[model samples]
Target chain A: MNATPEQVVELLRQTNFSTLDWAIVVVYLCVSLVIGVWVKQYATDMAAYIGAGRSVGVWLGVATMTGTELGLVTVMYSAQIGFTGGFAAFHIAVIAGLVTFVVGATGFVVAPLRALGVLTIPEFYERRFDRKTRVVGGVLLSVAGVLNMGLFLKMGSIFIVGVTGLSPDSGALTVVMTVLLLLVLAYTVMGGMISVIITDYIQFVLLSFGLLLTVGVAIWRLGWENIFQVVAAEKGAAGFDPLQGEGEFGPEYVLWMLVVGLIGCAVWPTTVARALAMESTQAVRRQFMWSSISFTARFLIPNFFGICAFVFFSTHSTEMRELFLSPLPGGASSAFTPSLYAMPVFLGHLLPTGVLGIVAAAMIAAFMSTHDSYLLCWSSVITQDIIAPLAKSEMTDQRRIFITRLLIVAIGGFLLFWGLFYPLEGDTIWSYMAITGAVYFTGAIPVLVGGLYWKQASTAGAFSALLMGFTALVGLEPVRQTLAKTLAPVMGDSETIAAALSAERCGLAALLLTCVMFVAMSLLFPDTRPDARQRD
Target chain B: MSVWIMIWKVVFVIALSAFAVLAVGATIGGARDVVTLLNKLKQDRSNTKSDQ
Candidate 1:
């Protein structure tokens, strides 16, 4: 029998939360709270709070960094990508790791950034070039970071609402969102990097165990052959083929993922802060390389999960279609929650009681680890890097800590609102990230490279590169939509303007244009010689 | 196959040398000591530069 939506609903209904699941989430939450608060005892000063006192050894940093980069979204999205596109998603990990290695090896970003002792990426811009550059870069990074985070609150709440058996639109999503955000803010605001690093370490441990459990269980239930067979028959050539499955979105859709993940990987302020947290350039290189390895392992896991989801759903499509497409008010078709519910379905059906609890704990751990670090990373950048500079007197560490906490709450509040209203269209979390990332990655590249290599890369040049990159990236939405509408009648393709313009070629084109403009503008208006840029 | 495994093992060992530093950070005291040491290094470098 062909898979139907009814079967999917049956599957969803069949997989209700058990006592074991509750135990897992509760134990994990308690452990997280303890680990988080415990780190505060070591946080004596601002540096400890912000940068692990720059004493973070390479392994711990690598482990934590890998864990942070691969959060709940990674698990969900990688699986979604795998389910749909198969090996193509796997290629992305390989591509991302290789680029990371190249950049770390060649001093593409790290060397100059580390040497500056700056707290945020924009601070580097401000110091290397001008205030205008800092402001532009800062604003862009924040917007991109926040908007990209739109899914986190919604997804987190969805997980809670789904697991707890609350209807999707039950007003409880907001409450769950508030509670989780508060938990992250509490530890992050208290200890800064100290709390962040310590909690991240603990989180890394739990998340790895969770991943292993999931992988092991999936293998056990389906057997490798069964999983592969299902995926092959269901997804057909397109599912297994790395290159197919463009659908209504077109090729630019997939290409954008690669561009954004690769470029934006280095562009985040937290990443730079983590790099600077190390003791030496050698340490920075080592941390990132190992982190890359950890990332490799972490990245592959998601694709595996994604592929598994595809197989599972394809085989059970009849059930899912009925479950999802039924006339339920405020509830999306199971497809809306497919990736979110993928693991839950597997756990409820496949695992025995004790093991199920442990895996669920791991899942929560994975989510919290990423969320806490993000809170710590962003708040620190805003308070120490941006706010303090604007203040007249040197703010005390106490004041700084207070402000960072306040900002975390403020940012969390803002995200709560966004998550509540913003609807998910397409597999958007990653796409939004990629598009925004192109802005940051390409923008920072010119200024960073010029700061290191080109003697003639004036402050004006840096400023212009930053401004142009920011403007171009931020402006892409309108320009793309307009272009899409304009071209819609001409070309019969149903592709949105965003998808049409996001081709890898378009991304590369933007990169080239930005680089040339930066050079031209800088030479036309010089700020500092390359020799002068190196202070000592 | 053995040769590839051997190569990876050697790489892992080298990576462990770096890992040793991070392991030190596991302990609160050890992490603090490392931070203090880096600060001293930064200060010494600055002092030497000024002397020159």
Candidate 2:
């Protein structure tokens, strides 16, 4: 909503999204840079740079893991789900927490991977299969990972736009996206994982306060009972019932949530990097166990904010309410309305000035922590698994660090371009993330599990399984749309068929197909004799 | 369905409480650890300088 001169004066007086918040953001960036400078000298070796010299303790481990996982993009998307899906969105959190807790309790895939002491997931592929498999896995992983991160810049910028009331088409969107990227890349390129860990602890503390304050403001401004009542009234049984058909999450989605929870904590590379960086296997387990709370709270809190935004917009006067309620029926190809901005806009109205500044700073912390860790994680994989293997001679530590830094900047540049140009079309950002991530994790889950556990897992089986995961591309909305039309004669309705191809169903199908391929390939081609590595 | 909702609500309450306790514990524990780590790193840097 455009503020009148009087309204603008009143908003500035009341602490709306303003220059003071930007100052707060700049201060947070400076603090992070100082921390980066302080930590830079320690990252002389690749081991120290990539894995913090495998010395992260329980608390620092939890703090860094939480900071890394709970990105501003995470909050934005979770809030989107909550805004549209109502209380049904809580199921994702419950599933995420429960799965992470289970992994922590059982020392599942992660515990074993840590015991193996691999720097990246593909490094495990090399040990179990062959060097060739590792290189292929690395290439596929980096591509999928980079693609998966493609939308983070845009989604994060949307949160800033919505909250700070920037025009969507304004060049400021590009500027914000670029600035956040440079800040994160600069620190990550300087100190690597060591710098990421130090900054994360600071970010974690700020994030906790900002998180609690937002939820408190949301509840205080809109009564909790009223929030639930409006959802129930507007959405009925589906609003409160995650398992029912009235909402977006039903049994299929819940089943999908189970897969997400498992892969997220166990099979995902970045989170697993934390476990690999820990002091001990037990510490790794304890980290996940302690972090399960942060995982759950991360989703639950933002989701609550989204629901509150929905309620607040429903009651309050603004241009945002109408746009949020607009039916953007063109789907994936359609440009998004301001609905994604609703939660942030609500925060701008609710928070007073200094409090707004603090929350904004906390969010900046969230943004940097996630980006730096991800950039480091992805670039480290490209350096360690992909390029280091290709080089004729053993790579010097300096060269490895140099390559990783260059890759980080390159990736950052790509993200800026992708964020600006990528057409989201019909799918939700969260769903898009799930589908793209499945491109790697779907294949990796079966291969990693089989390699780690099942004695029959072979090089042939691993290659086949990883290749089979490419079929998950069908899960993307555009791909589904194209396929639906191609098969329309048999499918009956193109739109129905397209709509039926949810990311959850597509992922499960990919997992199953890859599992079959792995088992079949391994059994049929039975290694003349099991490799010694396999037996070991 | 109501049973399912009840089950989830109960589970959520338990999970939230458990998570809150763990987060608090980790934060306190981690803060102390971070201080010690930075101090040790500082000592190592100084020792290297002296040896040089």
Candidate 3:
């Protein structure tokens, strides 16, 4: 398994392409398209398109949540993380699930928010805080959503093309983006949550089938024990230890993720929309409770896939070093390359032709689900949060729908442009997602908690929290660069160390610190008073 | 993947993944059951109130 250049080349040669692989890819695509087309019957109006008419029961919500959460990049990164960092990377998935479970159990944040019957999280801010606070939250959520979506098309294209052994850099980002948008628009524009949930059920089944095939083939090639041994020998202690490594994230990373997972998970516009789509609080809570199981199961498989890739790559150190150490455009580090390449390499090496195609389709499904939700999420927030609040006219439902679809086109178009042209500099896709998330993750707690608890939390606190959280994220950029430089010698390679550091820490800190600041300021500035229009 | 273990793993994955599907199915089924039960309870309550 220690693949030198010669070994890699030989492996590539041994890997025969069959008709079965092509068949798998074709079949998967056709089925997903059919599902998209079929869901049209459910769409009665715009509300139905967005929230499935608040008709989503527990099962559909849970399934759709799983599908939305498990994106192509998630699988790719998990495999990549496993390939490089060993078992430690699995912690990310574990913590996310456990935290989500805790959130469900407590019924603390989202349960109450869902009970309020508001459309979006930012709308909650408008009701609870001031117009200015809502605007800030809305803008922040939209930007966060857009930036987080920056890599989807590129990453999806990479996975699809790579699995098919086609041109990896097809420069087809725009075409791919358009295809994804059209697919999402077709059903999403129709029945909204109904279409999303119904389609997601089928997609979830197919993806699970595909992942099982991939895992089976890999285990057949190298027994699980052998895989574990190879990885253990290669990575030593740091490989499996989630707490250690370059970031010095240690326990704090876990703690931060737990808090973010608990509070931030519910606050995101995309998820908030999903919660609102449910028929009732009981439905939302029950769906999540059941979802906790599915979430945990899916969580482990991807992490395991990652760990398997790590073990498989260990004996192939020469290739690993080459993949990691190679300079990316804009002086991007090798750390970014190998992990990114891990899933592709694993699929190319392991899967049987028929199963391979199925997996390819599953990857595409993941991409589409993520894209559709993101498009819907940001667009809704923008319309409801930013535009509608500011506009003097009471908007009609028809007008609202028109604006929503238009915003989708506008925002989706921007992402396509950014995805194609955005220089891959400064951060990994994971960090970018997290950093953008911190914009809300850090700011929301004060607003949400204050809205729920303290009547005295004035507009000043909300504004300060928003400003302070953004400042933390923006300020961390230079600090990150300096930290990378300072720790370069000890890290052996500075960029990976730097990339790892940000992914593990900064966002959570910024988010948590913002929460702390909001509470402190609210207590201190008690006399600032509330907006009368916001309350009864 | 061991033959036996692989079979079990496949089954487990399928079961876990089908949760969402089951949720939808159950909600419909559960609602019907609930409605029927509620109706029965209401009829008995009305009859008792009239007799009293």
Candidate 4:
């Protein structure tokens, strides 16, 4: 039953993607583009363009919300954790669903946000604090948001390469990244959120069918008992338990997942845009409450796929295992993506021919839907919040839309360049995303929670908390290494320094420090504005 | 699997089943809403065209 290495290579070649497969992907892309262009007439103003006129009904909201949030990069990273950490990784998804459900039931942050009907989160800041605070928040948010999206193109391309049997070092990777970016940019630049919502609905349908099919096939092909058996045999208790300190996740790591789970759905702009775009506060609640399932499945399903990959590789012969994890020719381990390629590579062998094409197309849809939403989100924030606020004159709806389109192009350009250049090392792609996003959410969460609930929240407090979030800059490999080198003499060991300032610690530290700063500054310099808490 | 793993397995099942139920119900509910909204949009657009 074990696949020899040659059989693995042969399997990869057999499913090298047929003409029909490419046609399916192309047709999906064309349909999305046509829908985007078609929707432009509906987006007649800034509200229609950026927030879909705040008219999105519940089902449309649920579908689009899932489409935007359950991005291909999300799948890639969740699966990566599954392959690396096994079933213990499922905790992340459980926490995600539970937090989202509690938030919905309690109407914690999102309900009030929906009630305010602000097009963007910073607009709330402008109302609660001041325009200057809004502008500063926008700048920090865009910096973090844009960087957060930077790796998206690279991760998506990696999936395509891994799925379709393209050489990791091939020119094909760059070509795929460019083509996917262009497809997303075309529709996004044309119609904004109107386009995104339509495309996302369609993508939701395709993505759901694809995910369901993949899960069924995986279960049938590799019986449920066998998957757990192999993982257990190869890894023992560590594979099944995240609580085990010796595995990838420790106490700090789990604590960080708790923070990330709360922030990912609750505070992240892309997800919150769905809340802001909904027809009513009630619709927002129902959407989140309904979406709790997809939230859990989003990470749970992909993590399952990744766990399957680990099991598949482990059960196979040694050479088959080496095919994925082995060092590149004339080099150490692969500097690019590394063992993260295992999931799609394993799937390529597992799925039948036409089915493979559908799954790949579905992921492509996911990649585009997410890119479109993110591109629209960050661009709109920069235009309405950062640029428009600082400008001397008010922007017309047409001008605002024009500037937004131009900014989308600029951000897409940066993503392509960043994706090509940034070499991921040491950290899993999921951790990379969490830490980068913490740069924004770590500070933003407290500012939002306090600004909404706390009576004494001052502009000074909000600003200082945002600045404190920069403490998480230690999560960056280069930044961590630089600081470690600088402190090595004092610390007695560079490795110890690296271990001390891990991504989990940095993120936790950032969140705690920012929370403390927000509280302290608000109490120290209480805002005297009578209407500050009430807002516009 | 240990008792801890068994507990987690149960948790995963319950969570996944709950999500499936919610997602399916939402999907049907959401589709109905979409149809209604689209019809309204169409009605408004035609009304504007008639006025013009």
**lDDT winner among the candidates?**
4
DockQ of each: 0.07, 0.48, 0.08, 0.49
Better of 1 and 3 by DockQ: 3
**Can you tell me which runs of candidate 3 are displaced by over 4 Å?**
A1-20, A170-178, A246-249, A316-336, A475-479, A482-503, A527-536, B1-52
**Alpha-carbon shift of residue A87 in model 3 (angstroms):** 0.8
Rank by TM-score, descending? 4, 2, 1, 3
Model 3 preserves the real interface contacts to a fraction of 0.08
Error of 4 at A452 (Å): 0.7
TM of each candidate vs. truth: 0.82, 0.93, 0.81, 0.95
Q: What is the C-alpha lDDT of each candidate?
A: 0.62, 0.82, 0.64, 0.83
What is model 3's C-alpha RMSD?
7.7
Clashing pairs in 4: A59-B30
Worst 10 residues of 1 chain B by lDDT: B1-10
A19 Cα displacement, candidate 3 (Å) = 4.5
lDDT of 1 by residue, A463-488 (tens): 66666665445324445666677788
Candidate 1 chain A: worst 10 consecutive residues by lDDT?
A323-332
What TM-score, to 2 decimals, does candidate 2 have? 0.93
Docking verdict class for candidate 4 = medium
lDDT of 3 at A68: 76
Residues A237-339, model 3: lDDT tens digits: 5655656645323676667657656653466667667678777898777766666655555555666676666656555556554543344343332113455
TM-score of chain B, candidates 1 onward in order: 0.49, 0.80, 0.64, 0.66
lDDT of 3: 0.64
